[model samples]
Target: MTLEENAREHPYEPVPGDVVRDAATRRVGRVMDRMGLRVQLRPLNGGREWDAMPQDLSPASQSDAMSAAVAEANAQSWRGR
Candidate 1:
């Protein structure tokens, strides 16, 4: 299978916009899809798993912070795996 297929089968990486609510740590993922940057999101009450892309994400003021967090999460995830 191709690399993408392999990743899908064994998702060692997190996809962009995955709502991660693991225990006390909670975050909405805002990944740089091309770079696979996984940012931690500020918790919300409840919403769909996928959200608008960072460029088109609502409440645009937070885009920069979200992107930075995603980059950090991507780095950390890659290192851990």
Candidate 2:
């Protein structure tokens, strides 16, 4: 998908603990900057930084479906209380 489409689809505003992937290398990282979507990831070890902006990030359909299932399970657990 296009960058705009990806940006609009992501759930959060891109903050710390949010998962993002670098478009350049397709490596996943955790967002460290909310405003800029700057992500910190370490492929080797040192924790390099990568930006997700201007880059497309289409969440894998399988992962999205899995997330929805997990969310539903959590909701069901909460309702069982």
Candidate 3:
């Protein structure tokens, strides 16, 4: 079978809390929920959520996740000042 056929048969499905990158937006977010074929994602630092097709998402790299966490931490630290 062709790659397209195989992909259709077995699409990538990310569960809630999984970090992923949206190919369409080139943004990293955590899976918030799924609605039919579309998946909801929220920024790591916490912001408005957006919906993206499963086909447009892939697992985020470890560095991406860490970078977001560090950025959030830095923001929080500044807020405490």
Supply every candidate's count of residue pairs whose N, Cα or C atoms clash at under 3 angstroms: 4, 0, 0
Kindly list the per-residue Cα lDDT of model 3 for residues 1-81, writing each as its tens digit: 998898789977899999998999978899999998899999898878999999899889999888877877798789989
Q: Model 2 over residues 1-81: C-alpha lDDT tens digits?
A: 997687668643444654544567655554455344444433222244655563454333446445544665676678779
The list of candidate 3 runs beyond 4 A from truth reads 1-9, 70-81
Lowest lDDT 10-mer window, candidate 1? 51-60
The C-alpha lDDT values of all candidates are: 0.42, 0.50, 0.89
Ordered by lDDT, highest first, the candidates read 3, 2, 1
Better of 2 and 3 by lDDT: 3
Top candidate by TM-score:
3
Every candidate's CA RMSD = 15.1, 11.0, 3.1
Candidate 3: TM-score? 0.71
Any idea what lDDT model 1 has? 0.42
Steric clash pairs (candidate 1): 28-41, 38-70, 39-69, 39-70
Candidate 2, which ten residues in sequence have the lowest lDDT sum?
37-46
Q: How big is the positional error of residue 37 in model 1, measured in Å on the Cα after superposition?
A: 33
